[model samples]
Target: MDSIKVMMDIYKEDRSMKFNIFVILILSLCASLFAGTADDPNLIGWWNFNDGGAKDWSQYGHHGVLRNGARVVYDTERGMVLHNPKAGYLDPNEGHSGHVYCGGERASIADPCTWADIPRSYTVLMWIKSQMWWTPPWPGSPNQFEKEWQAIFTKGTRGYGQLIITTVGTQGRIYFRARGLQPSTNDHINGNTFIDDGNWHHIAAVCEYDAVTGQTALHLYIDGYEEYNSPVIATGSLILCSDPVYIAGSYGGSTKDGEIYMDDVRLYNRALTESEILTAMDEPIPSDFTGDSKIDMDDFRVLAKDWMETDYTIASDTGGMVAHWDFAGAAGETTVPDLVGDNDAVIVGGGQLDGNGAAVLTGGPDGPYIDLGANLGNVISDLEYCTIFIDCVWDGNSTSWQRLFTVAQPGTTEFSTITYVSVNERWLRYYQRHNAHDEETNASNPTYVPEMKGQHQIAISITKDYGLYGCTIIYIDGVKAAFHTNLAPCSLDLLGQTSRNYIGRGPFERDPLDANTINIDNRFAGKINDVRIYGRRLSERDVKDIYEGVSRQLYFKLEAPGNLSDAESTNSKVVDFKDLAALVNKWLQQVPLLEDNLN
Candidate 1:
């Protein structure tokens, strides 16, 4: 009886062990099916180095040749790594100390490892670690790459058609170079992040040719965050050269005599999305907890519930804003919603929306104007000070009086107006009729007038004192253009008047014959992008910050004075008479008038 009992216990233990093994295998299969996959369709080449040889893991069979003492080694942090130790080639003239050639000797586009194989939109990704810091001996102390650069990877020849990535300076600043189409179209970009602090980092470079803009955009991302992006014109096909793709060093007659480790190099035929890049930064998770393949809300909620069962609120950055009008509403909508306050605007007359989503006016007698209701017009009565800001662009044809903003009392001519007086100049005209008293004041700056032909930012600040009249300061594009003190006393009583407040138009005047007759002759032409009203006077820095926050674009036309190429021969850094003459010539060649009003 004792032997039978012992045999039953042994049988039960073996059965339990087998059941556990089966459960583990099922979970592994589930994880593989649901988690992020490394076999992306756009993947052109992948080298994990786990095979302990210079072999390609992808089915394309683009194997590499490890030369000049480069070897693979096992790493605890990063599995298999290509280790390139210092080979003592300190001179710049000496060739690369050690490197791995992705393509065999005398490789070209016809064979492999060239621009012809890569698509117009492509991405390069890898994990790298620098074991030592070595500054190259170049013209610029730490930045320029005349000869020596610790090359991470490179393709194509030196000048014509090439893409090279290298580390410069002791801080391990990343540098990139590429040339496509014209030789002058060669582009160079650099990163500010330092990765040489003896730590591992994931780096990705995405290059795409934009068909709409006819330009190429290159973006660099480190640790799943975009670090830099720039657009350059690429007019033709990239050059295909017979240079082998070099890893860890370059064959450009310079030696990267520093130890570096690289692992899990990947090349893609298309630019990977930001989420995909983030997934490549880590091992696949067991399940798609977020459902988006990203650690978003769903995953965060699970993590929070497991760690800490507490609720939290995230504060927004838009505090202390009284009234903000972004004007991002739909086209032809009569009502423009205010972002912050209850003061919405009603579009009147022939106001229409533009392609850029700004309200447009045709410089006509009955142009489009926005009317702020009576309730919001009276809100200013509760404050002792106020600031008004507007971003506007004038139509060059508007030489007559144009009112940008106005506050007035209905059934009477009592009002205050901020007007644009002339084409070559701008001034503020203030008038008020209260308690049977008529007062008027104006301010202007002769030396500096608001640029009427381009986009401009206008700001006005007013402060009212109990015993003295208020002070008014007007700013144009963050610069003080006009100021007046002790001119006229502001009345809280006038603000309370149940009159219509208007933007892009002056006071409402009625004809005696018809009470509903409205004169919109003072309506402003062009477009108004953003408007804001603060309950208190803002500092100069605050005004400047608001102006800088608005998006702006500038274009420069380059012309040849004596000879287009010879204009830059005087000094590489300074703009001399030749540059000015070239600019003048370019300006003369084009029509001497503004195009499309304000852009």
Candidate 2:
């Protein structure tokens, strides 16, 4: 009977635990929904060089490249030094290892001595694993046994293990050594500890004192806990070694070598308190992203927060995708007029919209000056007022598209008339038949219109300017349409005009007018597809509807697999991550994701 009651109690506790977890999960979901986007600027910093070479440090101090580029260099003695995503990692040689060659004019790949010229009073944190041991003898040192080897080396006089955070000179040293009359020059082995076994340990030291200290004021953290500090008689002048500092080794006069693996080394010029240090050291494994210490949802929260920013390094190994508008279009191809990707679209070139909101559809008879791809028209509905995406040409003829569009001061009140047409049309056949908008030999404003004779991406959004007369906003893509006041039920009339027309060069109504200067040739250039259509007005949630799914896989026109083995094989051919992501986006648009409690 007693056993049964105990089992019942255990089951009750289990249920309670599950209930708590359920509550946490629900709260997390709510928070995620509310915290749609939160930019974290603290993740920004300069990733210094760790090339396993003496000169690599020169990049930061003198020739440092701050971009998110990684370099791996190996040396016979130094083992491996990894400079990736701007952080440094180093592995020791078989038996011996350290940064900076013991005695050499030139540094071999095995010997790297490039210490970053970090600021004074900074925190140094990193993951260290070692199997090298050194403890004071039982009786003591040759004279008196010290406790531990000094872990951090800074500038101070008569090397005393001051243990102060960010030691500057000879007085700065933390280690286990034999107690004795402290040796003056470099012979001072006072209080040095050797715990360099093969076990991985996190070592961090923060030097806040600008000068030497005698009390527990100087702090040192080993695997997150603060170690005892020695009495400060701080009065050394070790030159902070402004040049390349050493790792796993120290060199003031002679050489002190250490065997260990160093990974995730970081330095900050601020002294963290004991609580902060403890929090950092005790942080769960794989939790810290920037290595500044505290870790929680903030790390994972960065993805959506800075979706449009390139502040942190996206882990390519994790299949993380980062898209920035860096790839311009190729020559002789217009791009912006059509949809570029299943996710976001880039609206490249579209003739300017005048202050009066009038855009001459035919670009000065050069040809049809505007083009609204068939698929794109399907995606955009309820167009009233909204921001527009367009690449415009500065046709030295300031009067060209620019004069009336961008030049006018807002109060000009030009109220230029523009037209929005809803046409059930096919592809480019109409324009090609007329030979009007020629892609052959036409160069209007090549500067802004990089692909004048080619392709471009463009979008015209009308939701933003619904109420404002002669106002307009456009985007390359409108998964969810922006809101506009005084919006009308009809899409075209929402533009303040009751117009119904087909997709073709107008006033092709007669002949292509040369004086009109409106030509589709000046429209846009690009392949456009995945145009979505909505009956009612939309919102932000509506836009999210246009695309679904966390991952996208591109479609390929390949032969079918011969058998089940081929289909189920893990080694099956696959597209790259970038293209796959785009494909996933396309699939999301086609079949929206089901947002359920489990997700």
Candidate 3:
């Protein structure tokens, strides 16, 4: 009997076990139980790394969660998990000054690693918030790669994170190195830049088999909206062996090196569709009122509609849909200067545009106004008023400058003051340093102008350029400036004409041909956000109101809100993969139920 049982066991192992019994059991269970929600197809695998085991990751990597054949980096400080690399950083040899690859496990050292069998195309996503910039060598530090990797997005020296790609060769060879695959493909994002600090940001990179029509894409999402994208470019095979993906650092063969914190690293075998990518990048909550993936009026409508249906218990992402007098609405009332020949008015933040491009002073067919009507007579908004706040970056640069709107002094019989506001060349230039009158007369080139690069914030007010109805008042942020000006109001008034209104462009002056002749492309570089316009002149109270209002508006617009449950009641809802699947299943079930009932 024993021999017979052993023989039977061998037979069962050699030949496939009959499915009769197992199949019957599975069928019975299926028939008896209710169907559960469908499984997520795109969730390749999830790893908390809590289970310390060598799981099979041939499909993703050799060591399951640990790819690149690297070891874990355990930091006693803050309990951060680091990874080992094939090489480490050591002082450069032969007076190179640049550090050389030490090649081994070392304490408190950051190194680069490679990967194995790189796939042709894939998508990589991760969450990283870092303060590594404050440490070690600066950008051009030794023992690091010569050229800095391109950041998908970044905050600056203050500390930031990014998703990037690069080549292995010392010469600038572009390839997808950070996430997956290498060696042979036509699509790649070699060296990109995307960094930010003290903030959790989502970064994703997608590559397609067909580089042309289905060109590869790299996205950097800060907060939510797709902040940046690269030109459609083709890449090669993404397989890696010796070189593995690096975290808190980069896979620079030899270039920029730094540290950062990362969470939720993910990779998709198949190139996810753009729509799916959008779903993954959005505010995780839907503030995109337009459904076009942007925070515009349509989205506002959704929030407004939802809020009206609910009690004050529920507020939209922007708190009751960007109000009129408050951050949730618009600035309903503000102080306006009485119209003398050339009076100045102060505007605070949170002022809403009355018309398309309301506060913008544009040039060309529309004669002149701020901003070049980039959004079709769209007033370029530079400030959002809420409550009392301080703004020092105002110069002319998009980063730091102020914009003013003027009505032009009553037309002088000798030379119409109206001409100042009716000129064709409305342009942009960096306003000179504050309170500095030494170089105000030089219209051709001001000594203290704002630069185009770097991050900045500017104030929007009315300057003295346009004569008639010059400036009724000026709003700082969204607040009404306390001091008014016909001769001297907000501050710096050396350009001749007083009573300047800060709209969406540079200050106004008596010389129509000289002042107010600026260009948008030339000025207002980088990005613009939270635009508002008011009809009344801003007072000190108004300034405070606008500052707080604008701050709250911007805050809610960018943040995830403290009261999520209340937010969900309004338009600030977050629908994950399960929600999508449930919706689809519900629709599918309806037809079958209807058919059965009819029969």
Candidate 4:
């Protein structure tokens, strides 16, 4: 980068570091300008609850104001979230209703871009955690709060779509209720899971219409899995209300009586497929495609591999493998058979083939990932020595929690071992939270994340010696990138006897300090070509043999963007003005991804 070079030159001249603050400021400004965003063109409105206010982050900048006692609370993962968890509506009236008031009438309500038209097909998504399920003490008067349901987001009146938290008999669930515009025919859809356990849950309500059948289906998804699908239609259209859209409560502020913490409320013009909803982040390159990182054989190799169809079978075979997944299934395949074991993976969303050897995952903090089943914990849990190998490519630069591999318990408590990359791309984490409520993760560091730019072969091995010292080795493309030796029990261990395992997802993705799911914690976006689990730790040589000694899973098959390298191969991918011309000349011959800069 020219800026970097100038800073470096100034630093060398001054030696006293008078320009330190300026250099840091420039670096920060650059990163912020290029940070990933919610880029779906179909998105009409988005309220991420950041900026400490209810500002719409989408193209429609219809900013909203808080209603009633609604207030923004700081969260570690999601900077700010609406904290409105009060259920008291009637007798005591202690229950405070809160919402983001997007002012206007009907579809025009709070919409400056005119994209918020009521449609027959639409998708609304949000993350919620019910603080409590409090009801009026005396069930004496049925003052509309008699039912244990409150609207989380509503468009207009009873004839429009709304997402709610309610009780089905005794099941605390995420519910969807919608009514067609014409005759006001209604559909009340119920979610299967009890969501009031004070755990954050991702929920989406989609109404899809088949033009041929003239029928509409309402689908409910909780935590990336579909819980309910019901078809009810006789020609449908949303009722046009003069009511303004509301988040955290109903249009008129009369609802949202349910107490819950909410964030990332989104509205799409049309129904979105699960893959689209959970798609990975793809940022646009500023100038050079290579990011001006390095230009070695590795860069050339990454460029070549970008065009060539990846061969999943090339490294599919490995001795002593307890399990392996060569995601070479067809598009729309719901099942990805485990190549070496009976632990076949069930696809919830977008495990479809990438047309290449890898499998596509649109990438989101929520679903459309490969669920390796609860039984996997029985086989892969609690091993002192083992190797977890993955062949994949990541699209985005950072995620607060993007799980590459995770084995966690399924219940409210999060007992799990998670190998992940957090907000910064600098380190690879091997964490073991001994208990669900533990405040600290045992991921004090030992592994490293390479300066990865494109497809890569990553192998993490754990070997314990008789001396009770654990050696953690991380290899990138068969070469040892980082290695550390630490006393046993201090390092990460997959505690025995657990049942939930997944690829491209985390066990809880919850903060150890607060135990709250930031929702964006496990949004691993990229394509997973192949994965292998060895019962024993892999030696450096063994790891090399499995990979092509080169630069090489989902949680989708995402084709990562390539980076540009300077003459020295410093692995600096940031494109700057100084190297643009040289990068263009070399880009034609080296990295063939001319389109990499476009997306």
Residues 321-382, candidate 4: write the lDDT tens digits: 66888877776666778887788887666557665667776666564677887666766554
**Model 1: pairs clashing at backbone N, Cα or C within 3 Å:** 561-582
Error of 1 at 411 (Å): 66
**What TM-score does prediction 4 earn?**
0.39
Whole-model Cα lDDT per candidate? 0.58, 0.28, 0.30, 0.55
**What is the lDDT for 33 in model 3?**
25
Candidate structures ordered by lDDT, highest first: 1, 4, 3, 2
Candidate 1 lDDT trough over 10 residues, lowest sum: 552-561
**lDDT (Cα, tens digit) per residue for candidate 3, span 1-599:** 35334334534764333233223333333332212201233444322121222222123332333333233332211112223232233224311111112111222214342232224555665454433333311111112122334221111110111124432232221234223323223233432222221334455656555655543444333322232123245443332333223333333332343233343344555566657665655423322222232222333344445444433231333321111111122233232232211222233333332332122222222123322121211111211111111222222333223233221111221110111111212222222222332111111111222331232222333332112212223232332222122332221222223222333334333343544543321212111223333321222223443455432221222232222233233333333334333323322333433234325
Residue-wise C-alpha lDDT for candidate 2, range 366-390, written one tens digit per residue: 3333333332332232233222323
Q: How high a TM-score does candidate 2 get? A: 0.26
Error of 1 at 214 (Å): 3.1
Candidate 3 regions exceeding 4 Å error are 1-116, 132-195, 211-229, 235-241, 249-257, 281-501, 504-508, 511-564, 568-599
Global CA lDDT computed for model 4: 0.55
lDDT of 2: 0.28
Stretches > 4 Å off in candidate 4: 1-39, 85-96, 106-115, 132-147, 157-171, 181-186, 229-234, 252-255, 280-599
Winning candidate number (lDDT) = 1
RMSD of each: 23.6, 26.5, 18.2, 21.6
Candidate 1, 123-233: lDDT as tens digits: 788888776333311111112222345778777444433666777533455766665644454365665444553456688877776677666666777766655233344
